[model samples]
Target: MNLTLKIWRQENARAKGRFETYKVENISPDCSFLEMLDILNEQLVDKLSHPVCFDNDCREGICGMCGLYINGRPHGPDDGVTTCQLHMRRFKDGDTIVIEPWRARPFPIIRDLVVDRTAFDKIIQEGGYVSVTTGGVPDGNAIPIPKKNADEAMDAAACIGCGACVAACKNASAMLFVSAKVSQLALLPQGKPEAARRVQAMVAKMDELGFGNCTNTYACEAECPKQIKRSNIARMNREFMCAKVCSEE
Candidate 1:
């Protein structure tokens, strides 16, 4: 199928960026979205023109590095999939696709479709781990955690820090990403010891990094590739309130 792609091009974070259009023909319907871009780049390189730059590692969708705003939706029109998992068949022949990087203040563009996501790293560093000393791994039955809690924890842990939550939000909020990190740990016994500290520090760092507030628009939940629920955001709010209240006591 032949298609037109209007993609964002930026030289650097400080450089002015603009949309550049290109056409690709005879692309296979089975070709992944990144593969289609690769075909486009090869054509550009063969002509001695600069190729488009996009972030992608582990094209299997586990890495969450291949994020793109396609036709105004995070990760194209598909649900519960990353850009690397998107196939060309999702589009119609002769369609014009608009692709752009995550448009958030915290995620500044580096070049053509790549944006710096290290702000997520900064928030994770603030407190997204089980730091308290727990002895060696015990028997699986030793903890005896409720099945419901374990399932929810595992669900929350599925978050890949893709930044789609932020990109989908009108306010560019990172609440869903941050909440998933917090919930995955807080629901487990090993993480309870530092849960209060973890929630407070991570939320503080998220705000400090210039991420916007969640206004309950639910866009973050809708666009998340992992389908991380907004209930995690609610849990995070409760965690934050408890932390704040405990500190005063």
Candidate 2:
């Protein structure tokens, strides 16, 4: 198949950016979106041109490094999919694809299609941890947590932090991502001790990182590759309120 691509190009963080047109032919329908970009970069490199830069690791879709805005949607047209896992068959021949990076103040473009997502790392550093003392590996049934909460915690923990949530949001909010981090722990007994301080610290860290406020439009849920539930945000809000009340006391 043949495709016309309008991709955003930026030299560096401070450099002005614009869309450049290129044509790709002989694409395999089975190739993933990032693989397609890889092909484009190889072609440009052969011509001694600056190859497009994008972030990706563990193309299996667990790393969350492969973030891209494809045709105005994060991760293309597929539901609950990341760019690295989006198959090219989703597009037909002669399709014109517009590829860009995550557009958010917190995610500054380092070069073409690559953004600095250390803001997420900083938020995680703030308090996304279990304070329980570690010895050797404990028995599987050492502590019996209800299956329901365990599954909910695992679901929340599945978030890969790709920043699609921010890219899809009109306000560029990180609430969905932040909430997933908060809820994953708040649901576990191992997190009970730091629950209050953890929520407070993570939320404060989120605000400090220049992330936009949540407007509750649910756009984040729509774009999240992991299908992280919007209920995580609601749970986070409740945790935040409770944490604030206790912190004030």
Candidate 3:
């Protein structure tokens, strides 16, 4: 299939950027979206031109390193899939695909299709983890966790921090991402000790990083590759309120 790709190009974070169009021909339908980009970059290199810079570490969807706004949707038009997992077959022949990086205040454009996602790392550093040292693997049967809580924790843990949630929100909110991080720990016993502090710190850092607030639009959950739910936001709110109340006591 032949395709026209209108991709955003920026030299660096402070550089002005715009869409630049290029044509690709004879692309295999089975080719992954990144692979199609790779082909386009190869052609550019053949012409002694700079290649399109996009993010991708693991070609598989596990690592959230790959993210792109294709045709106005985060990670392309697919549901529950990342950009690297998106196949060229999803687009028709002779289609014009518009690709851009995650557009948000915290995620400034670094170059073509690559944004600095270190904001996410900063938020995580502010307390997205349980630091308790469990020296070795404990017996699985030692602590009996409620099945419901365990299931919910696992679901929340699915969040890969791709920033798609922030990209999808009209307000560019990080609540869905922050909430998922909070819930994964709040629901687990190992995370209980630091639950209150974790939620408070993560939410505070999310705000400080210039991410917008959640207004119940549900865009984040809809575009999340992992299908992280907005319900996590509700749980986070409760955790925050309870923490505040307890701290006041």
Poorly placed runs, candidate 1 (over 4 Å)? none
Candidate 2 versus truth, CA RMSD in Å, comes to 1.1
Q: lDDT of each prediction vs. the true structure?
A: 0.94, 0.93, 0.93
Provide the lDDT at 123 for model 3: 92
Worst 10 residues of 1 by lDDT: 240-249
Poorly placed runs, candidate 2 (over 4 Å): 247-249
lDDT of 1 by residue, 1-249 (tens): 999999999899999999999999999999999999999999999999999999999998888888999999999999999999999999999999999999999999889899999999999999999876768888888987999999999999999988999999999999999999999998998888888989999999999999999999999888889999999999999999998989532
Could you give candidate 3's per-residue lDDT for residues 1-249 as a string of tens digits? 999999999999999998999999999999999999999999999999999999999989988999999898999999999999999989999999999899999998888788998999999998898897888899987988999999999999999999999999999999999899899999988898888888888888999999998899998988999999889999999999999989542
Report model 2's TM-score to 2 decimal places: 0.97
How big is the positional error of residue 13 in model 2, measured in Å on the Cα after superposition?
Answer: 0.2
Residue 41 lDDT, candidate 2, scale 0-100 = 88
Please report, as a residue range, the 10-residue window in candidate 3 with the lowest summed lDDT. 240-249
The whole-model C-alpha lDDT of candidate 3 against the native structure comes to 0.93
Q: Write the per-residue lDDT of candidate 2 for residues 68-178, one digit (tens) a residue.
A: 999999999999988988999999999999999999999999999999999999999988998667789989979899999999999999999999999999998899999
| TM-scores for every predicted model | 0.97, 0.97, 0.98
How many collisions between residues are there in candidate 1?
Answer: 0
